[model samples]
Target: MPGQLFCFGFGYTAEHLAARLLPLGWKIAGTAREADKRAAMQAQGIDAHPFPLPDPAQALAGVTHILSSVPPRDGHDPVLAAHGGTIAALPDLVWAGYLSTTGVYGDAGGAWVDEDSPLNPSSPSGKARVAAEAEWQALDLHLHIFRLSGIYGPGRSAIDQLRAGTAKRIARPGQLFNRIHVEDIAAALAASMAHPNPGAIYNLADDEPASSSDVVSHASTLLGVAPPPEIPLEQANLSAMGRAFYAESKRIRNDRIKRDLGLTLAYPTYREGLAACLSGAVSN
Candidate 1:
């Protein structure tokens, strides 16, 4: 479709998504929290500006697509309180997406969860995300929610963790987690935008949901190094907030996105994805 798109809190995911969508003939605009980053975005051919966190009442004129990659706040997002109306009032906007977390489906004990699964978030951040998703869903707009899992890609993967000597296999029993390569996320998003599916919830995750230890062990094996010593979940010395995540166990399902958006993920599992990251493979 021929339209202008806006991405709020345009971080890593949005950056990669924008790079893909631009060449496909979509006009783009995005927010920057820093002045230097704004300049850098403009230099890289993005229409860069500061979009007030709680977006202002002023309309964005003709933006047809909007994606919010802003991580949910620790408790509540005041941005939603202030700018929800502004977002809801956009007349020309056709598709709006809220990036959330699968942690909202708290402690399923590795049972599978699809789009219609109940939300019982354990962490403060996850609870906040559930609330945010509610706000957008109630807006009567074309809304799609992406409950993302562990996000890893080029410079942000097991390789980085292993090389830095910070890769530890935390012995959290049944703490299965899902992940998606950055390229697959970008691809899934582009598919959604191109073929708008409002009021849809997509679990943006890979096919496999492996335990934390499994990932660490596989990553170490791939690197031809010994796995890091296992740290018991209780004695792991995690921050109070980090410990909250360790408290839950769940596995995400991405079948909805596959059936709806026709997404065949480039990296279907952490094993393939992490291997690609280590071997310098790119998504086609």
Candidate 2:
């Protein structure tokens, strides 16, 4: 079915998601926070609107599906809060997807975490996300949670960081990291959109989980340059928020997405994603 979809906090992920969904003959609407971005969205020829959650207008009226790309800020998501009951009341809305992070599973010490893993978020952001998910799930609406890994895509890849001299090689002692290209996440989102499963939870991570240093090092290698010097976790200059992310580690599994969605990852690991992007294999 060609569903009418609305994407809240439609930023990077939603942008790519809209590209895929639009082609599949779905009616798509997205949100941009900034007025400048709204104008930019118009220039890009995408129907990106501007709105906040927790008190959404009639937008959810007939929305058959919705994807929330916005993360919880300060324990409140206006969009989700405002429309929780309203959305639940809408019989047409089949699936409501929340793009959460595996950080909710907390620092598993590189242990594997599936959908059944108990949430033990170590960071404020992750805790807020978990709270937000709970709020949505309590709505008695069709809900799905997609726990995303580190996101990378064209123009947002590690090469951009390298060129800008902002790349980090944070050595946090065997801190395993997972990633997924924007396109792959977008494809996975589409698969879920087409095949909506109520209350589904899927981990959207790359097949290969490498250490932080390994990923940056590999990206530098693909670009034919020495990697940025490693900065020990203690010595690294990071904001409280950024540092919080380094405090936890988990090797997320994507078996549920693959098995349920019948999908295969294009970039199973950072090597493939970076190699292809650095080599200009991905089009802008």
* Poorest stretch of ten by lDDT in candidate 1: 51-60
lDDT of 2 by residue, 95-140 (tens): 7888988888889998888889999988888899889888888888
Q: Which model scores highest in lDDT?
A: 1
Relative to the true structure, candidate 2 reaches a TM of 0.93
lDDT of 1 by residue, 1-284 (tens): 56788888778998889889778788887788899998988887787768574335443557888888876565555446647777778888889888888888987877898789999988778888888788778788899888899899988988779999888789887788888899999998889988987888889999888887888899899999999889898778899777988887777889888998999999999888889889998885
Candidate 2, superposed: residue stretches over 4 Å from native: 53-58
Model 2 global lDDT (CA atoms, 0 to 1): 0.82
Clash numbers, per candidate: 0, 5
Model-by-model lDDT, in order?
A: 0.83, 0.82
